[model samples]
Target: MSTKTPTEDDILRPIKNTTSKWFVLFGIAGLAFGLFLIGWAYQLMYGLEVTGLSDWGSGGGVTWGLYIGAFIWWVGIAHGGIILSAAVRLLGMERYMPVARMAELLTIGGLSAAGFYIIVHMGRPDRMVTSVLGHYHITVHNSPLVWDVTVITAYFVLTATYLGLTLRYDISRMREDLPSHFSPVYSALTYGYTEEEDEVIERMVWWVAAAIIIMAPLLLHGGVIPWLFALLPTYPAWFGGIQGPVFLSIALTSAISGVIIISAAFTRAYNWDHIITEDVFRGLLLWLGFFCLMFVWFQLQRIITGSFFAGISGTYATQAMLSSVIYVGALAAVMAVLIFIFAQALRPSLFTKTRALVAAVFVLGATLFEKTFFVVEGFQTVEFSIYEGVPGPYFPSLIEMSSVLGTIGMVTIIFLLVSKVVPVVELHAVEHLQEGHEPEQEAPQEVEA
Candidate 1:
């Protein structure tokens, strides 16, 4: 076993260091994002028509397609990420502390991407100001779309507060160690700092964590998000009571898979094998598997309901999904990953961090594919009788597909930029580890007399 002790230097390396490799990666990410902007500009200049999206259940096209699918997918990943971080704090899951800040950052990045999809899907950027904000007072009570916007706003504020509160503690203590160029940024975040406030900050952060936990089900992921689809009685494929729990499961699954990917990448880049550790990967794999099982169970619940109990339109939707090769294959891929994760859990010898990372990547893609299919099929089979053949061979246009790469690049840029300014791992995490590694004082032996 490795015996290297944890230190502030380990956490601060990203901030203090500079390298050509980091710049190269940043350039590549920028290029990817820039390319997407060009695609987005093309869409904006001509129209969303360029995306092959059209009116609902007409001309074999969908009003909602990859854009909406990707939005939900990003939101799930974002919401799930905060939930993971909150769990680490509130539940005292110290093993996860090393990566909790990374998850928090992921939440910020994911939400930005999700929000970008909203703007891209809107076609006209002005509509947000004119349509949503202009009519907010009237639509707040009746519109699911408004509810989504409201909660996302609240979520963003809450996450920023959570992250900022934690950073004050880290940044103030490490001021001398951090780069001088970012002093203004650090000063603003840590404004009004005092050594005594650490205790108060701790309590305040705990309560914020509690608030996030409450919101996860009652307001955000399991509430308004699902309501967006469930409240639409006209769309039989979308309406269901179980959407809240189903979405919650997907959020957790997507979030865990995302965390795994982020954690693994950082671990490799920073030589954090001893820090992030094989044990951490194994533990994370088990959590991912649990959530995956929940996702599968929830899906099965919906599938059976749609297939049998959900009337004509819903049954047709379910049957259509069941018959689709793409849908079936995606579900099978999720199941295979789920089984592999569980097998690794049961037989410890079979587990490798590499396999866990691979599982994470596979599951992330599988969840996205499933979510995208869910979005498309809902429209495809909306009307069982009259519009039976309306939605056919639905696929995202090149521009639509490019949004995915753009959002990913966007998230990468977020992480890359943030790592330069702040320690990606929390200062508290390193200190906690430092304390844990302190050699114990042995009891004095009595003289034999």
Candidate 2:
């Protein structure tokens, strides 16, 4: 056996191994997906009538609050993967190489959930046929909602394609071991080639990079989020022109952190220590650090600008974000303290396992904070009337909560399914490292006397 330590790339390529673990993960996701289907079917059978929503009160449909909120939140979380993959490809950032494939997979998995959430949110889901076929009853010029649909759909396709091609690239390298039955699926996924697929893969990769550069910023416009904010007559915090973009930044920050958590969890679950190398952890930590800073900046900006807008309507919006326990202000404070502590404890070195674990926890907390705020704050921004000239709290009812949880389950299921089929990391990109490519590792090992 060779005694030399392998390069990061060398270990990332999947070995021809299978265990019952994939089934277990898939089973959990499937259960969640099934729950979502139950909720979905219930909504379909009863229509929006089963929900606590009323046009007379607040348009209290499940559509605007939890379903749409989660839709935008998940979409925000997804942008990190898109940005990371596209940025690395464009800038030739080799450090990002280890995680690029997984990042792309994250984009596909997250966005697929976002799409499903949108469909589930439709009050008249049956009318989705008409909407997709190009009928529109609502429109606002330069609406984030419209742009969101366009860009998100594009991303779903582009990221899925990119991931599929990359998976194909990995499978092609393992052609010797791949069974005959799986060959066609592998070839089709890879765009139908064996040897010279690099050129095709490289070109597609750059195209996605370009798309990411353009669409990432556009994707941030709070998309469906601003639409949700617009539902409120009095709430200005979520309605401001800057709110959408600000939320976008928060989304990217959270999504990246979530990816780090997911990566760590999967590695631990599979005991694939070699594949998820220190380099990958290091790269993620660096980004998580930057994310911490950006999140703080965004929160401060919202607070400062929001404070100045302290008239009745503006003040309400500001208070909604700043005072709501579950929403904006508290989470921001927690993130600030946690991130500072994490940054101090974390070193730039990827080899430090204890520090890496701490960093992962920070990223997860910060991202979850950002997402919780997106939903809870958005809910507060909309004003509601209680019985007979009284104002009411914006709590989600039972059905709404169920629906939201169901969509989450759906997202988990889709990603779980994909993981079973595709190599989540790029195999070929790392395989070259094992072929006597790295200088230091090329030397023969001496036997003990």
Most TM-score-accurate candidate: 1
Cα-based lDDT for every prediction: 0.86, 0.61
Candidate 1 C-alpha lDDT tens digits along 66-112: 89888999999999999999999999999899989989999999999
Candidate 1: regions farther than 4 A off: 56-58, 383-389
RMSD to the true structure for each prediction, in A, is 1.6, 5.1
Clash number for candidate 2: 1
| Model 2 per-residue lDDT tens digits across residues 1-449 | 23343443233223344457756866776776677677668878887556544332344322245566566667776776778777777998765565676677677767877777667666666545665535444532454444556667777887777676566666666666555666667667655565776887779878867877776765443455555564444555565566566666666666666667667766676554555555666667666667666667776777777688456666666766666665554455546544654655463433464555655555545555455556555544544535344233445556666655565666566656555555565664455334534556567889899
Output the TM-score of candidate 1. Answer: 0.96
Tell me the lDDT of model 2 at 185: 70
List the lowest-lDDT window of 10 residues for candidate 2.
54-63
TM-score of model number 2: 0.81
